[model samples]
Target: MHATTPPPSTWWSRNWKWCVPVLAALLLALFAAFVFGILMLVFGAMKSSEPYRHAMKQAQTDPAVTAALGAPIQAGWLVQGNFSSNGPDGEANLSIPLDGPKADGTLFVVAKKHAGEWRYETLAVNVDGGERIVLEDDAAMPLP
Candidate 1:
């Protein structure tokens, strides 16, 4: 009588232990990357908006802000706010962090867009351990 040959083991039965964890790790990494991409997109949009640009400009140029925070002021990355627009009308309420050679601060802006023009309701900077400096449209000192 001839001896019977054993059936070959399936690929799944041989590789599943390693494959499962590897696949799970890959999926986790992909999901994390997707979330990070979304956050960057949102932050980039806000940073590029007109209100953000205007507020930053005002903060950087104001004499009081410079005196408190020093020159070469820079905006921080993690800005918190709500911004919405439809055609010629929109609203923006933003809290932006700032840093410079002398100190750190937060810039707050409340604005609305009408007739395609942004009108700021409130624009101010609160220097760390110092007083708040309100920026007015007519109050910006001419840059030297």
Candidate 2:
């Protein structure tokens, strides 16, 4: 005589036909959501930061970018051309709903790029739409 043993399942494998597809769908949805979230975050950062000239060029035509930044962008708006040295840079151009002010006055900015991110050695603000603030030292200045 011969004896045979039955396989055991932990409540999941036993429900293979149903569990598999459900798990696969859930996993697939999770992956899709994760990917979408990452994309939004990266794109949001890029959109919020207002990087460079090409982006500026795009901003001209993209109402969303324009509405996002509160103010019309112009060249020499970035830290390199605006500052005297390399360092952390931030443009509070877009708060949440809009970018910045458009009234006839200077745009004042007070910002800090979290430690280990970027250096803030030089800064400028076009107050009254004319002047741009700057630092007199090599070290980063407290946002003014």
lDDT, each prediction: 0.93, 0.41
- Residue pairs with colliding backbones in model 1 are none
Every model's TM-score: 0.89, 0.32
Which one is best on lDDT?
A: 1
* Per-residue C-alpha lDDT of model 2 across residues 1-144, encoded as one tens digit per residue: 898887766776668889889999999999999998986665555444533322334334444333433466443322221211135434332211113444222222233344324333322333343443332322344666
- Quickly count the clashes in candidate 1: 0
RMSD of 2: 12.7
Badly placed stretches (over 4 Å) of model 1 are 1-5, 139-144
- Output the lDDT of residue 44, model 1: 90
